[model samples]
Target: MSSDMNKDWPLYEVFIRSKNGLDHKHVGSLHAADATMAIENARDVYTRRMEGNSIWVVESKYITASDPSAQDPFFDPAEDKIYRHPTFYELPEELTHM
Candidate 1:
């Protein structure tokens, strides 16, 4: 292979969604020259068993993750917002769908 092809391009995070699945779960990471190559590589490397119905490949540089150490402050607001929970509200007996 040419040196350009063998060179590490960029890191990519892979996510795979199985058949009839609603959400994609992170599988692994790999290096590729671009988004197109990332998807193709992810499929060949991670889905060789035909386990995935859909694949998502995101460049590692583009992902913005919350700081794990700030979890208390980051998630504290949701704890105080009890109204967001379904059990917080009592649906009338007439509303069976809820």
Candidate 2:
């Protein structure tokens, strides 16, 4: 592997907002020497047309997520408990949005 592609730099997840009317979305990832460099790289790759106003660079290592393969047993217990739902009670108008 190239020295630039070596283990020195960790992976990063890049998110960018293209315009005022659009929401930021995951564009792509790149190995940057640091956060600032990651942002610059993400801009070059994702906003070539000056397409974005905002950029977010998150180190992939910092992200913690549950395993999708365990979803059935991990989440299915709540599905059978219909009483947990508040549909039977009429909520006051002031609390309607809740």
Candidate 3:
């Protein structure tokens, strides 16, 4: 309604999972009073064409993300764990997704 009312609402990040997709992708952001309102707003705004089957909404203030500037050091630990990778394994020809 008013600018001040919108300003008081919390910002929410919207993610949508398509009918054929296994993972949810960030679509956009919106302002809502709470999580329930965020979800309804996201569905109405993003899935008007029935593009997605699932929706996820998260408050912007609660999310924690790594700093892009410190990417190298932050992800370096994962490089040392080679066993975590699937490159060493060979998949059978019948494996469709692999």
The pairs that clash in candidate 1 are none
RMSD per model, one decimal: 4.3, 4.3, 3.0
- Score residue 46 of candidate 1 by CA lDDT: 95
Pick the winner on lDDT between candidates 1 and 3. 3
lDDT tens digits, residue span 1-98, model 3: 78998789989999999976489999999999999999999988999998799999999988899899999998988988988988888888898876
Candidate number that wins on TM-score, 2 or 3: 3
Relative to the true structure, how large is the alpha-carbon lDDT of every model? Answer: 0.88, 0.88, 0.91
Q: Give the per-residue lDDT digits (tens) of candidate 2, residues 1-98.
A: 68777589888999888787788888788898899999988878878888789999999999898999999999999999999998798877887557
lDDT of 3 at 15: 91
lDDT of 1 by residue, 1-98 (tens): 55676466878999999876479999999889999999999989999998789999999989999999999999988988887878967788889866
C-alpha-based local distance difference test score of model 2: 0.88
